[model samples]
Target: MRVVVQRSKKASVTVDGEITGQINSGLVILVGVTHDDKEADAAYLSDKIANLRIFEDAAGKMNLSLLDVGGQILSVSQFTLYGDCRNGRRPSFIDAARPEQAIELYETFNRFLREKGIQVETGRFGAMMDVALTNDGPVTLIIDSKDKKA
Candidate 1:
């Protein structure tokens, strides 16, 4: 499991010109699942992301977690995160999980976030969607469950 997390002031996703998910003062998370990703991976990431202290504090220090500020999440399914372009112009999606497995884990990841008492909104999985956001601090980070060093 992998995610590209972007801190945002406001965000929304549109499908077929209709708003699907939207949020204010939160993170826009692009989630991806690989062939070997499991529920444990989703759990780990949800915990880590909910507690990541990327938001600022009263003293202008980056010390507030999303939990601290009561932020929302705009989650988007992004299989292309696993695209492998090492040897050719065309990206290979062989490392990406099949839709059946991917959607299950993706829902699990969102459920874990909601269980943590955070509001989560999500785009339609496997849909052609349009996402827009006002990136607060332009702060973004990439995290992968497979990179846990323990």
Candidate 2:
């Protein structure tokens, strides 16, 4: 499991010209699952993201967690995160998990976030989505569950 986390002042996702999900003063997370990803991967990432102190404090220090500022989450499933372009002109998605497995883990990841008492909005999985956001601080980070050390 991998994720691209972006802190945002406001964000929204649109599908078929209709807004599907939206948030304010929160994080926009692009989630991706690989063939070997499991529920534990989802759990690890949810915990890490929720507690990541990327937001600023009263003294202008980056020391506030998402929970500290009561931020929301705009979660979007992105299979293309696994696209392999090492040797070809076209990106290969062979490393991405199948939809059946991907959606299950994706929902599990969102559920874990919601369980942490954070409001989570999500884009429709497997759909063509248009996402808009005002990136606060332009802060972005990539986290992969596989990077967790034993």
Candidate 3:
């Protein structure tokens, strides 16, 4: 499992000209899954992201977690995170998990976030989506469960 977490002032996802998910003053999470990912990876990321202290506190220090700021989450499925371009100009998605497995883990990840008492919105899995966001601090981080294990 991999996730690109971005702090955003606002964000939304549109599918076929219809807005699917939106959030104000929160994090926009681009989630990706690989063939080797398991439920444990999803669990780990959910907990880490919820508790990550990236939000600014009163002292202008990045000491506030999403929970501390009562922020929402806009989770979008993005298999492209696994795209490999080492070989050629066209990226290969061979590392990405199959749609069925990806969707299952993706839903599980959202459920884990919801269980953490966070307001979580999501984009339609496997759909063509257009995501828009106003980056708060332009603070972005990429996390991979494989890296954690190593």
The C-alpha local distance difference test score for the whole of candidate 2 amounts to 0.98
Which has the higher lDDT value, candidate number 2 or candidate number 3? 2
Local distance difference test, candidate 1: 0.98
Q: Could you give candidate 1's per-residue lDDT for residues 31-106 as a string of tens digits? A: 9999999999999999999999999999999999999999999999999999999987999999999999999999
Q: Each model's number of backbone clashes?
A: 0, 0, 0
Candidate 1 shows a clash count of: 0
Please report, in order, the local distance difference test score of every candidate based on alpha carbons. 0.98, 0.98, 0.97
List TM-score per model, in order: 0.99, 0.99, 0.98
Which residue pairs collide in model 1, if any? Answer: none
Question: For candidate 2, what is the total of clashing residue pairs?
Answer: 0
For model 2, how does the per-residue alpha-carbon lDDT over 62-141 read when each residue is reduced to its tens digit? 99999999999999999999999998799999999999999999999999999999999999999999999999999999
* Worst window of 10 by summed lDDT in candidate 1: 83-92
**Better candidate number, 1 or 3, judged by TM-score:** 1
Model 1 lDDT at residue 20: 95
